[model samples]
Target: PRGLMSLKSFRDCAGEGMKAMMPANTILVLAWTISGVCRDLLQTPLFVKTMVADGGISGGLLPAIIFVVAGFLSFSTGTAWGTFGILIPIVVPVAQAVDPNLVLVCLSATLAGSVFGDHCSPISDTTILSSAGAGCAHLEHVSTQMLYACVVAASSTVGYVVSGLTHGSLLPGFASGLIFMVVTMLVLRQRNKQKDAAQA
Candidate 1:
């Protein structure tokens, strides 16, 4: 299937092909879905209130909080897809009605934030899934993935300000940023290797 590959394994040159040199290096993921209702039941009510807060004070800023809370929930639950599903639709309509112009940016910010949290989170399902599939440790996957995603996310935030509307574009806004990021990472890696070789 040629599923996901790890940046650490790529940079470290752990093995020449799909097979990992160290079999125990990988994490194993559980494929069956967790019950979403059970998850909601377990989440902190105080935190939920904060995300879906109403009125003048906490009201308008709720989207920002939704992003943050969803992040924590996703991280712990290990499934960003599930967490985001719960929050996005709830936040969208409200944000749109409040300020049409700011809605896109706000929404991107929220999505970006959710991704940011999930990428770094030890328990995030993507982290676990990637690690399990890549034959890498969960932490290894999280650390490397976090750096890669953060670079693109920061860049995407800028792009959001410039081109984040129905006034424009398509998907893999995720993938495009990832390409520039890989190039930048490679350049940085080459520089470090050179420095290390010279010092050696």
Candidate 2:
């Protein structure tokens, strides 16, 4: 009797797996290279001095700024890990310089923003893998997920601002963000229902 698992079947399976992983591998390499360069630049004294001297980046808005910057970087690179590697070292010191009490808040903002961007980015490995796993169009998956990601990001931005203003208190900031997210989601659902009714 023939073996249940043929050599030809194994070869085909391996080939398909490698093909599915190629995009993620390529993105990882590119993201790591870019992060290395950014890490070097960010560590320079000139860059640190300039950043610390920037008066606008201080006070109760610093966490919001950091969150936005982290989000944009991760979204453009499509790699949350790379974003974290690039931003954490730089942002942590800067936050400490600006306000010692805000170190944890800024760190949390960076993490949250990077996650939000990775979730929404079309080229992110997680996004790509999710679409492939679901057997759906990649762009369709990104488009569908973008709305929800944006809603959460908006809420998080508000939370960051509140946290910064309140000197890093978690409770009030979290409560405000949760309220905003619930209200926004409800509004979106109501609008969708109205549109569906009108179409029907």
Candidate 3:
């Protein structure tokens, strides 16, 4: 019935400040935050532990490896969101007690790892939907998506390292590093485009 913000002038509320910065996608961030809240609220600890079995918690590399295995299976199950629902509650509190300072770092690792698992799995719903939607064979979707997810996951690990060093702040920290990732992706895209153009 009503159009959403024909003018969308935020300067009326916060001077020219909001209009000058982050105007195009603040709503997207807000929507994501709301979704995160819903996910958190519905998260159940017992269910999480049920999904995460006891093993590597007893020793060194084992715990980390266990997380990796869990990440892979949960995601391959075609439900990263569900996998996260089953892991974060179990991971977060223990991670926080281990070191309050590294909370975000640990969370990012867990979340991103799960996404890595789910996105490339042949049976994953998104993977299936993507192939079906694009009119491509399912294996092609899985194959191509795997390459990008691996690269991004590698970048994300480096991002977590930088964010941890700087206390995960936006100013001269996480935000600045994001610019590097964006630039890297853009340059890669341009290179591919040029190669395609030359071949054409």
Tell me the TM-score of each prediction against the true structure: 0.46, 0.78, 0.52
What RMSD does model 3 have? 12.2
lDDT of 1 by residue, 62-155 (tens): 4345455665665665555555555555445655554455456556655766677767788765577778999987777777777766666555
Please give, for residues 1-200, the per-residue lDDT of candidate 3 as tens digits.
Answer: 26544445543656576665563245345444544664467453333333333532321122243246546855656666666655565566644444455566566666777777878778776788789999998887788878877666555555655555555443544554467678779989999999999999
TM-score, prediction 2: 0.78
Q: What are the clashing pairs of model 1?
A: 78-125
Q: Which ten residues in a row have the lowest lDDT in candidate 2?
A: 41-50
The model with the greatest TM-score is: 2
TM-score for predicted model 3 compared with the true structure: 0.52
Off by over 4 Å in 2: 1-54
Error of 3 at 149 (Å): 2.6
Off by over 4 Å in 3: 1-73, 170-200
Per-residue lDDT tens digits for candidate 2, residues 1-200, read 37878898989999999998786677667666665676575454246536656745555787888899889988998988878877776777777777788899999999998988888888788999899999999999999999888998999999899999998999989999999999999999999999999999
In candidate 1, position 73 carries an lDDT of 64
